[model samples]
Target: MTYTHESKKPTAARREAQKAFREADAKVAMSEYERNQKAFHANRERLRSERLAREAAATAKAAQSESADHVRKKRIVS
Candidate 1:
């Protein structure tokens, strides 16, 4: 008995299955990328807000100290 050689071309069903698998894989990858991007932006925004709060506190402290100094100088000169 002689066996037939394998065909070089894939069957239509196999091609359809491969295409579906590739599309699913790409969809999963895109969702993962979006998740990572959202996390990154959230972290960046948190850091920015924290920095601004610290700067505001520092500015308020400096202004308070400067005003206190002015009051002390007036009492001393009188």
Candidate 2:
């Protein structure tokens, strides 16, 4: 019959090294998440600003056309 040997328990140094590796991995993952969140917010703000600028331009164009029409009508009447 063949006998099987048990595996040795992990040493203190090996355990500490594993813990450090885990901490480093977690730190990297957290920083990556924060970076992605910041980029998302920046893009969202840019889109909002663009939409507001377009609305303001459209309003100005409408006002200018209305004023021009009013001037033409007044000249004809006079």
Candidate 3:
């Protein structure tokens, strides 16, 4: 058998290519958004605070387990 100097290059994966395209599109959209908000830094801060407050509220609510009694009963039976 003859020896080869190099291996063939692999084709790009379709899914990976699609993901890269999506990331590039997101960057373009964000730049446009920043341009539009150049005069709205205060609004951005307010919106960020509101989003953080909402997130904290949701997380606190999620931390309160409603099925503690059920879990204890199941453990006892097991």
Candidate 4:
């Protein structure tokens, strides 16, 4: 007679418990990922808005200076 060593599979209840723990851990990880992503997107949006406002202000200033120069040239011509 030959004796063989075999590995035993986990019982159904143990498998179920492992599955539940894995699912709970995955949910926690996903929530943390979502929170970080939201914060990143919010910061990016805020920076983009600030950049747009600065550009608008610069454009407005340039246009005002150009208009003033045009008026001065007209007065000189007259």
Candidate 5:
């Protein structure tokens, strides 16, 4: 009995399958990256808005106290 030696051959179907897999992987990666970026920006915006609100509240309170003090001082002097 004689056995034939194996030969290296490239197949079209295998190449097509490999190409499809690469494309699918790229799309999945891009989608995941976009999702992460969206979450990050959302969190950043939320933090910034919260900080601005706190600052505004503080400013309003300080202004009110200063106005009250001014009235008291004027009344005492007059």
Candidate 6:
């Protein structure tokens, strides 16, 4: 018996299916990108706030030390 081969031509239904699959894949990729972007922004904001708080604390400590030194000098002079 001779074996028969199927036609290689693509059908309309197959083309439609491929298009649908591509669209779905694109949507999934876009959503993942957006999620990553949001996480990056949130982390950046958190780090910025922490840095500001640390700087403010450092400034306050320096001011306090300066005031203490000034008072000590006054006591020594008097």
Check candidate 5 and list the clashing pairs: none
Comparison by TM-score, 2 against 4, better one: 4
TM-score on alpha carbons, each prediction = 0.77, 0.66, 0.37, 0.79, 0.76, 0.76
Tell me the tens digit of each residue's lDDT in model 2 across 27-65: 999999999999999999999999999999999999999
Q: Model 1 Cα displacement at 14 (Å)?
A: 2.0
Q: Tens-digit lDDT track for model 5 on 1-78?
A: 999999867599988998999999999999999999999999999999999999999999999999999999999999
Q: Write the per-residue lDDT of candidate 6 for residues 23-66, one digit (tens) a residue.
A: 99999999999999999999999999999999999999999999
lDDT of 1 by residue, 1-78 (tens): 999998789889999999999999999999999999999999999999999999999999999999999999999999
Weakest 10 consecutive residues of candidate 5 by summed lDDT: 6-15
lDDT of 6: 0.98
Model 4 TM-score, 2 decimals: 0.79
Clashing pairs in 4: none
Tell me the whole-model lDDT of each prediction, alpha carbons only.
Answer: 0.99, 0.99, 0.84, 0.99, 0.97, 0.98
| Candidate 4 C-alpha error for residue 51, in Å | 1.1
Cα error of candidate 1 at position 35, Å? 0.7
Off by over 4 Å in 2: 1-11, 72-78
Model 6, backbone clash pairs (residues 3+ apart or across chains), number: 0
Clashing pairs in 6: none
TM-score result, candidate 3: 0.37
